[model samples]
Target: MTSTTDIKAIIRRHRTRDAAFAVLGMVCLLVCIATLMALLVDLAIDGVGRLSPGFLTSFPSRFPGKAGILSAWVGTILVMLVTALAAVPLGVAAGIYLEEYARKNWLTTIIEINIANLAGVPSIVYGLMALGLFVYQFHLGQSILTAGLTLALLILPIVIIATRESIRAIPGSIREAAYALGATKWQAIKHHVLPYSTGGILTGVIIGLSRAIGESAPLITIGALTFIAFLPPAPVQRTFPFVNFDWLASPFTVMPIQLFNWVSRPQQAFHLNAAAAGLVLMAMTLAMNGIAIYVRYHSRKRIKW
Candidate 1:
């Protein structure tokens, strides 16, 4: 319907405008990738020299000359694992209950709003909650348990949000099919919906864990001890027995916490150690993210629709 000259003019306009838009988008993406690459390169350059077995095996030292981060490394792992065990299941369960069982009423709406708000609340607030409840009221002291609980509280909203999203992403027809087949809500969710959503849920859990591991403020505010000569043996061997883990009651430090401590010290040795520790922290985090990406990739491949 258009003349050849008109069509060519339209095409020429689109060619210029579309080219500009594409170039803008590509430039933004390239900037982000370049920034990340720079960060990793800097970490490697600063830390590669100090990476060693002795660095990983030594305990907290009175002098920067003699210190290693073994105790802090172990403590970080213990705290993270315990928090994951507690928060992931509870958060996911709460999310499922809200999404599947709760009524569409004002009270439920309020609860959802509150949960969403809590997600945005600063980690320092969780720290205050831990200090008030675990230290002063419950007498758990400034132990690993206290820190884990604080971290759990800080990350619970994230876990719940992720879980709810994963569950919601499951097709409603699947649930309806189970219902039409004489299956109860529990049976449908248990045998079919949950299984289908498990991969997504796990992906969310791992991402939440990744965020939780890098948190330093909440732990510090909740009284994560900066120095501990001995690694916590377990949950029961700790001073606080009521919390189900003894490690919760003792003084402890994590890799991030130790790195922060080292960085604040005014010495070249501490600086080098901090860089090395930062390298370790980044490596662990990158490895976790890599695994999450791989899992998510494989998981998506298995989905039928």
Candidate 2:
């Protein structure tokens, strides 16, 4: 019903709106990148000189310049090991069961909904829950085991969600082909499904672990000390068939906790230490993500379907 002039005007208006939106989006992106660059530059300038062997090797000290992150780094690694071991297999298995075996039932729906909801829950909430169940109810005390288990729980939902998405991305025809070759359901899933989805699964693991690594609230909530001065006892005491897990019960402090403690202090040197610790944590996270990306690239290249 519009006249030619009115139609042209409307077109011009639409074009203007679209251009405005495009500019806005670009501006937002640029702002984010600029802020990130500024932060990284500041961190580097503040912390680069502090990233010395002495800082890496020594235990944390009351004196800022003498402080090191050995105990913190070791505890972080140990806790991550426990978290990965506990979460990966169980989460992946649960994802497989939900995707491959679960029917379209109310229970399945409820579980899926709950998992999605849990993913959005605050990390601090997980900390409180861990504090109650693992710390108090289980009487695990403020130890590496309790902290690791809490993180495991915190990241489990992420793993399961990632696994499920990875599995779903595989074409159904692949499963049908495996079945037609006289493979059982379990065999089909084990061989065809898992092989194809390993890339996404690994990516998910890396992401979840990265999230766990940065987390402080849950660890703090579970009573992880911020200024741990000593390393946990070694897992192996004797050389003859040596293996012991007593160290799992030892008190722990991770990089994030250490960094938090440093940042909270009144000393300028402590702030610099925090920055260095931040760099280390950032490096670890980036390394994990890089490995995941490489794995995904190779996996996709090999998997044509």
- What TM-score should be assigned to candidate 1? 0.86
Count of steric clashes across candidates, in order: 6, 0
Worst 10 residues of 2 by lDDT: 235-244
Q: 1-305 in candidate 2: lDDT tens per residue?
A: 89999999999999999999999999999999999999899999999989999998989999888999999999999999899999999999999999999999999999999999999999999999999999999999899899889999999999999999999999999999999999999999999999899999999998999999999999998888887888898877777658778779999999999999999999899999999999999899889889888988887888887
Best by TM-score: 2
lDDT of 1 by residue, 1-305 (tens): 89999999999999999999999999999999999889788877877787889879998787775778899888888888878988988998988998889999999999899998998898888888888888899998888778777788778888888788888988899999999999999999999878888777888777777788888988888778777778775555345454455565668899899999988989877887888888899877877788888888887889985
- Judged by whole-model lDDT over C-alpha atoms, candidate 1 comes out at 0.84
Candidate number achieving the greatest lDDT relative to the actual structure: 2
Global Cα RMSD, each model: 4.1, 2.1
